[model samples]
Target: MKVRDKVIVVTGAGGGIGRELVFNLLYKGAKVAAIDINSDALEETLKQAGGDGDKVSTHIVNLTDREAVEKLPEQVISCHGTVDGIVNNAGIIHSFVNINDLDYDKIKLVMDINFYGTLYMVKSFIPYLLDRPVGHVTNVSSMGGFLPVPGQSIYGASKAAVKLMTEGLYAELKDTSVNVTVVFPGGVRTDIMKNSKVEGVPSTNDTDKAHDHLLTPKEAAEIIINGMEKDQYRVLAGKDAKMMDKLYRLSPQRAVSIITKQMKKIINK
Candidate 1:
């Protein structure tokens, strides 16, 4: 679908790829509703958009709040007259702990935000999107959705749910005007790790080393928009993400083992 002149709602538009996406969409002539829980970060994103004030709107709402998310479609429609697309991008990571030791509350929080948030957005926006000739839903999964990571098991599970859920939507909407795209992004230059809900896990302080080959948020957002325009079913954002996708498809067991070993190396370092 053409992004130019589209009315798009991007959740979690305060940081990382979401922030860049808001700016990029504005540049492409799309009217954007930038939603996030962080008022300060959302203001920063609005400033970065550099557009006429009417072209952009900001909503500070927690995605995990079902009542709030349920009311979003009407608000967006009232603001923009109609909704052409929705990007389910809000997410949170759990503490880097094994399932046995993982905090139940933290896991619940992660699942509610990452998995249920995407579902809520899709559920809330479908009617509005169906009113359009062609609409798109871009749900951001992760490389961990396909590849099992040692410390982020819960995070991976939430993304896995997104993968299946998005694909299910694709199947259900195959003959419809609405399209679905799932994104699998590798490590990116985001503050996710720094702001993640990790309790006792030591931060990966060597940013340079940890993100040696990470893509910048701008680059990742560009890839996402390109994929959305083309209506790709699955878009891998980086070489590592593509490789992981290939490995998982070729041999799930072997891929899991390899990724587990790699995680061991990173954690031990």
Candidate 2:
């Protein structure tokens, strides 16, 4: 669906890919309702918008709260008059430790935000989306969602659930006006670790790094929006994600081993 005159709601709009999505959507002439848990970060996103900031509305929302999420469609509709699409992008990874060493509280937190959060947004807005002439739903799953990373097993599981749920929604909504697209992104330059408050890891804002190997948030956001416009079934946002998706399809065991090694290196670092 074309986003030029549409109103799209993007979660995790405080920073990272989510913030980038808000900017891109606005530049594309789309109105956006940006939702995030961090009010300051959301304010920063608006400030960055400058003159076009009026096209964007910021909502300080915790996705895990079902009551809050349910009210989102109405609030967004009040702001933009109608809703056309939603990008469920807010997520966090747990500490770099084996599942055996991880606590239940941490596991639940990851699932609640990554899986249940997306689910809440999906259930809440899909009905409204169906009411529109052309609507879309984009869910951001990680490369770890498809390829297992030893240290991020729970994170992977949560994203895996998102991946499947999105695909299933696509099938279910095939005859409807709402379109569903699931995204798999590899390592991206974002402050997810610090935002997640992962134990044992120092607060290193990875978003500052100009590493060519990692996909920048702006790049990732562009890819995602492009996919949404074309109504793609799934999108691999980065070279690594594309390569790894093929690798996993060709040989799941080898893919798992390869990512396990990479995770070990990150954990040790």
Candidate 3:
């Protein structure tokens, strides 16, 4: 489970937390296959990885494609000789829109990229992971996955699906050496809105402006990798997520009211 000297494949390795994961994993002495849809971005990440080029490799693939995902385990094996774990960090946000104003196409798009894409990678890599004496899987689900966000309903739905799917995987793989972890990341300092290509809205959420407590990508990555090293079933990055988890558990209606009020203020503004 420790990434040190282990071969780990990471998706969405172009920027944000994914890129940070690559840098951190390599620093921890893991043989890394950095994957992303943007070959140029991957190149950028590779360049930023500094030395240890021998321990790092890059791959370009769209995770939504099952056939493309199916080839990943083999490609990583060819590059690194063996696989030890995977971090499914690739995801996209939905256009900020209310449920009634939402476009079905947009919902489908987010679902394909954020939820099904993660599932494709898990499905493709499970056999190989099972074959290994020990392996790990980490899925990045947003805090919105559990706490319903007003404008990002579809995005929340997608991530919520990932949360449940990952939890189910952990139960199924309980006896196996493969550990499953689902990460709940609150607001982190990243260009996720730009990456998701949001239009006609401020990139940051209303609450983000009120509280500048976003975690840095590197910090988030460190927390995530630490959880992976320990084979944790759940990893909450950022204080907001940790706090929200407790609040939601304590009072679902009150939690929804608090978040919905913040988002509604932005919508009405």
Candidate 4:
């Protein structure tokens, strides 16, 4: 569905692709409700909106808080009159470590924010989306969701859950006005490690080299919004994501091995 004049809610709108999405949607003439846990960051996004700031509203929301999320739809409606689309973009990764070394708390935190967070947004807003003439649900998964990345097993698992759940939602809503899209993004330049409060992250030259080809947030957001506009079933946000998706489909084991080698540079031993 076209976003022009529509009220679109974007989670994680404080920074990275989510912030770029807010800019792009406003450029397309859409009103946006930006949600993020950081009030200051949300304010920054609004401040950057400049003349378009009037078309946006910022909401401080921790996506992991289900009660807060459940109240989001009504709050958005109250501000924007009605909501037509939701981009489930808020998520985080755990400290780079094997599942064996990862504690339960870290695992749960990853699952809660990455998988369950998206689930809550979907559940809370789907009913409202279903009622709209042209509604959309876009969930951002990851390349790790489809390919195994050593030391990020739990992070991959959470994203894999998002992948499957979004696909299922697509099938269920096929006959309805609500369009569902699942997105897989490869390396994107962002402050995810800092935002996730991940410890012991390597800043070695090798690690930087490994991520030198990462997509910019604006590029990733453009691909995602284009997919949403076309009502695509799946969107691969980077060239790496697109290539890896094909490789994983052809030979999962080989794909896993390839990524394992590349990730070794950054994964904490």
Q: What's each prediction's TM-score?
A: 0.95, 0.96, 0.95, 0.95
Write down the lDDT of every candidate, Cα atoms only.
Answer: 0.88, 0.91, 0.90, 0.91
lDDT for position 53 in model 1: 66
Q: Against the true structure, candidate 1 has what lDDT?
A: 0.88
- Candidate 4 per-residue lDDT over residues 241-262, each given as its tens digit: 9899999999989998888887
In model 3, where do residues sit more than 4 Å from their true spots? Answer: 204-211, 265-269
lDDT of 3 by residue, 78-145 (tens): 98899989999999887778889888888888999899999999998999999988999999999999
Model 3 lDDT-worst window of ten: 202-211
Residue 192 displacement (Å), model 4: 0.5
Clashes of each: 0, 0, 0, 0
Instruction: State the local distance difference test value for candidate 3.
Output: 0.90
Q: Considering lDDT, which of the candidate structures 2 and 3 is the better prediction for this target?
A: 2
- Decreasing lDDT order of the candidates: 2, 4, 3, 1
Q: Give one digit per residue, the lDDT tens place, for model 2 in 131-225.
A: 99989999999898888888789999999999999999999999988899999999888889889987675434443333458888999999999
lDDT of 3 at 242: 94
User: In the order shown, what is each candidate's alpha-carbon RMSD?
Assistant: 1.6, 1.8, 1.9, 2.0
Q: What residue pairs are clashing in model 1?
A: none
| TM-score, predicted candidate 1 vs. hidden true structure | 0.95
TM match of model 3 to true structure: 0.95
